[model samples]
Target: MPFAVYVLGLAVFAQGTSEFMLSGLVSSIAADLGVPLSAAGLLTSAFAVGMVIGAPLMALFSRTWPRRRALLFFLAVFVAVHIAGALTPGYGVLLATRFVGAIANAGFWAVALTAAVAMVPDRLKGRATAVVVGGVTIACVVGVPAGAVLGERWGWRAAFWAVAAVSLPAFLAILRSVPGGPRPEAVPAPVSVRDELRVLTGPRLRPTLLTMALVQGATFCAFSYLEPLLTRATGLGAARVPAALALFGAGAFLGVTAAGRYAERWPTAFVTYGMAALALGWSALALTAARPLAVLALIPLLGMLAFGTGTALITRVLALAPGAPTLAGAFSTSAFNLGAAVGPWAGGLALDAGLGHRAPVWVSAVLMASALAVAGVRRADGTVSGVRVT
Candidate 1:
């Protein structure tokens, strides 16, 4: 792997920290902003909505810009919004900042994913995706738990400031390591934006995109409420939540690592068994929510299955949309974040309906089951319709 791939991963770590940290900080944010918990949870949804809308739009608008330049520009906007979010006193102002920051973050993902894939050979695509997506797992492992501690000790604003501080180095690293030149040959040659858009909508790609959204939605439905589920329903102490989160992230890191090795060879298996296992895990989690030991044991397992499956689905999207890497990145990013948005909102509805914290876990299981059903569809030849898993 090129040193630049790691640099992009480092930048993703900074961005992903902010993206995932909100889950740990939601309670603190709700109290500080004098809003209901459900309202505070909407911050995550707002960010997801921004990503869903911004990815393709930003990709198209910045399509002609130098890759390095586009990345830096997006990172700068991301950092600036974190600072603004940290300083804002009103909840509306903070929410607006999150939305804008997500747009910037989505743009960065669009450019950076294309750049990372273009840097590697076809055989190494899965490994490259793992290296980039590993940043998110690491954020979940380190940055999110750290943010939780910071929010508990200081305020949620401190976590926002820390995200901005961490991102500055990424901005510098990207500036130094990523090239500012003509596009690499590994990238699909330039095509009309219309043509790229057409490829994105092709029959072969639609199911992959739908699967992306459903799988992600399923994973996040439980994840968004993990802290409350652990602290409130499982009888775990507040201090232990961070450790559980770390364990979950560790599982995700391991899953991504494993997927890098086997996903390309067995993408179908990854998607099929992974989602089925996730559904079972969440169902078990809901059933065992009151048992601290069982809850602790399951978190890491579910995290591993969820992310490993996600990495494979991503590899599939890229394969399906070979002619439009940037648009593919944008659309895949949108699909995942679309799930991110809906998952939390669905979880919130469960909470609002007087369902216990365990309700979201059941919701996750149902969502994953739906994802599995989508992925299970096959042709007469016993292969997935329009998909040739390599």
Candidate 2:
């Protein structure tokens, strides 16, 4: 792999930390902002809404810009927004900052994936993409947990400040490392909006997009409430929750690594089985929430299965939309955020309805099952390309 690919991963790590750290800080944020817990949860949904809107729109807006330039521009916006988030005096302002920051996050991912894929060989595409996505896993492992600790000690604003501080170096790294040239041959040509829309909306790609939305919806439904679930259902103290979150991150890292090895060769089976495993994991989590040890054991597996499918699902979308890599990548990002938005919102509704912390787990299981069924139907219809396994 090119050194530049890992540099892209670093950028992802910076952005991902900001994206996911909110999960652990929701309670603190709720208390600080004087909002309901469910309202605090909407911070996640707000960020997702930004991503859903920004991914394709920014990708298209920057389609003509050099990849390196686009990346730097977006990273700068990301850093600026983090600073805004750190400094915001009101909950509404904080929410608005999250939305803008996510727009930057979405744009960064859309271009970064294009750039990362361009740096690798055909056979290495899956692994290269995994390496970039691995940054998110690492953030989950290190950044999110550390943010939790920071929020616990210094207030959630400290976590935002930290994310802003870290992003500067990532910006410098991209400036120093990534090339500032025309799109590589491996990258698809910039397509017209109509053409991109056609590719994105084609019959073969629709199911993959739907599956992406459903799977991520399932994952975040449970994940958005993981901290509360741990404390409430599993009897974990605040201090212990970060460690459990780290374990989940470790599982996600492992899942992405494993998926890189097989995603390209067995995209359909990988996605199908991965979603099934996620469903089973969430179902079991719902059943065992009262058992602290069992809950601890299952969290990592849940993270693993969710992210494992994520890597494959991205690869599958790229395959399905070979003519529009940026748009496809953007569309895929949108789908994931669509799920991100829906999951937490749905979970909040469940909580509002007096469903316990365990309710999100059940919601996750149903979503995963729905996603798996979609993948199964797609497979049966032979809509997925028959790429020969190496």
Candidate 3:
């Protein structure tokens, strides 16, 4: 793996910290901004909405730009928005800043994933992707907890300031490590809007996109409410939630590392088995939420299985649309964020309708099961390219 891959990962780490850190800061934000908890929570939804829209839009706008240049631009925007978020006067401005920040965040992932794969051999593409995506898992482990602590000790604004500070180094690292501009030989010929749309809408790619959405939706359904579930359903103290989240992040890191080893060799089976494992984990959580030990054990297991499929799923999309790697990557990002937006909304509805904290667990299981079915059927039919799908 090139050192550049890790540099890209550092960029991801900075952006991901901003993205996931909100989970820990929502309460403090609500209280400080004099808004209801539900209103503060919309910041997350706003970010997701930005990602869902921004991935492809930014990719389209930056289609002619060199990967490294695009990355730098996106990171600059991301850092700017975080600074804006830190200094915002009220909840509305902060929410807007988050939305804008996520646009940059989505653009960064779209460019970074394509750049990482470009730097590696075909066989190591999955591993390259794993290296980059590992940043998100690390953010869950370190960034969110630290943000929570910062928010508790100081204020949510302090957490935003910290992210802004961290992003400056990541931007400098990328500026130094990444190539300055696009290689003339490496750039693809100009693609039309119709051609790009066709690539994304093709039959070979749709199943993979749907599977990505389902798996992500399923994972977030339970994951978005994990802290409350642990505290309310499992009787864990609020103080212990960070440790539990760290455990989940550790499992995710391990899962992604393990998946990288097999994803290229067995893309279909890798993702299918991961989905099955996720379904089982969620179901077990639903059944064992009252058991503190079981809840503790299951949370990490869920995180592991949920993220384990990342490499394979992205690889599958790249394979399906070999002609348009950046667009495909952006579309994959969009699908994942679509799920990210939808899952929590659905979970919140279930909770509001009188379903207990355990509702998300069951909701997640059903969604994962649905994803498993999609992958299983596609595998059986040999629809997707590259993999035997057997």
Candidate 4:
């Protein structure tokens, strides 16, 4: 892989930190901002919602611009929004900042994935995607837990400040490293919106998108509520939450690293077994919520399966949609974010119903099972059957 691909991963690490770090800071944010816990949770969903909306839109708008220019622009917006969020006094303004930051984050992601893939050969695309996605897993391992610690020691806003501070270097690195020009010869850039739309709506790609969405939804439904579950049900102290999160992150890193090896050669079996294992992990977590040791044991295994499967599914999307890299990136980004948005909201609904944190784990198990079903199904031609979005 090119050094520039790693630079793009560095950029993703900075931005992806902001995406997952909020789960750890939710309680502090809720307390400081004088909002209900439920409302503070919306901040996560708000960012996800923006990503779901912004991925394709930002990808389309920036398609004509040089890749370097588009990346820098998005990172600039992301840094600005984080700074604004850190300084905001009102919950509504902070909420708005999360949404804006996500749009910027989504734009960065859509472009970065395309750029990363463009730098490599077709056989290496899966590893390239893993390299980029590995940044996110690394963020979970380092950045998210660090943000939690910052929130615990200073305030929730400190976490936001830290994100902006760390992201600036990534912005500068990307400005220096990524080349400016038309799309590389390895991939063809879309010429028009209609052309991209036609490729996006193709029969082979939609089921991959659906499966990606469901896998992400299942993983995050349990993840978004992990802090609460650990503290309330598993009897862990607040100080231990970051460590637990770190263990999960470590598992995620390992998972992505391991799965990337087989993603290209055995995409179907990788996704199927990964999803089945993840569903079982969630079921086990729900069943053992009261046992601290059991909960800890399961966290990393679950994290491993969750991100491992995610990496494979995304690799599959890139393979299937080679003609439309930018839109393909956008669609994959949108699919995952769509799930990220709904998972938290659905988990919140479980809490609202007085079902407790364990309910969300059960919810995740069900969602993962559905994803397994999708991954397991195939047409007579041995292709994954695609579903139309409309």
**Residue by residue across 288-319, what tens digits does model 1's lDDT show?**
99999998999999899989989888878887
In candidate 4, residue 296 scores what lDDT? 96
TM-score to true structure, per model:
0.92, 0.92, 0.95, 0.92
**lDDT tens digits, residues 1-390, model 3?**
888899988888877888888887888888888999989988988899999999999988788888878998999999898888888778888888989999999999988888888888988888988888899889888888888889989999999889888888878888888887773324566666678789888766887899899888987888888988999999999889888888889988988887777888877678877888888889999999999998888878778888888557877787777667558779988988888888888888889999999998789888888887887777666744555543
Stretches of model 3 off by over 4 angstroms after superposition: 183-188, 380-390
Clash counts for all predictions: 0, 0, 0, 0
TM-score comparison, 3 vs 4, better candidate: 3
Q: How would you encode candidate 4's per-residue C-alpha lDDT over 45-84 as one tens digit per residue?
A: 7888999999999998888778999999999999999999
Best by TM-score: 3
* Candidate 4: stretches off by over 4 Å: 27-34, 185-189, 380-390
Order of all candidates by lDDT, from best down to worst?
Answer: 1, 4, 2, 3
Candidate 4 residue pairs in backbone clash: none
For model 3 the local lDDT of residue 197 reads 81
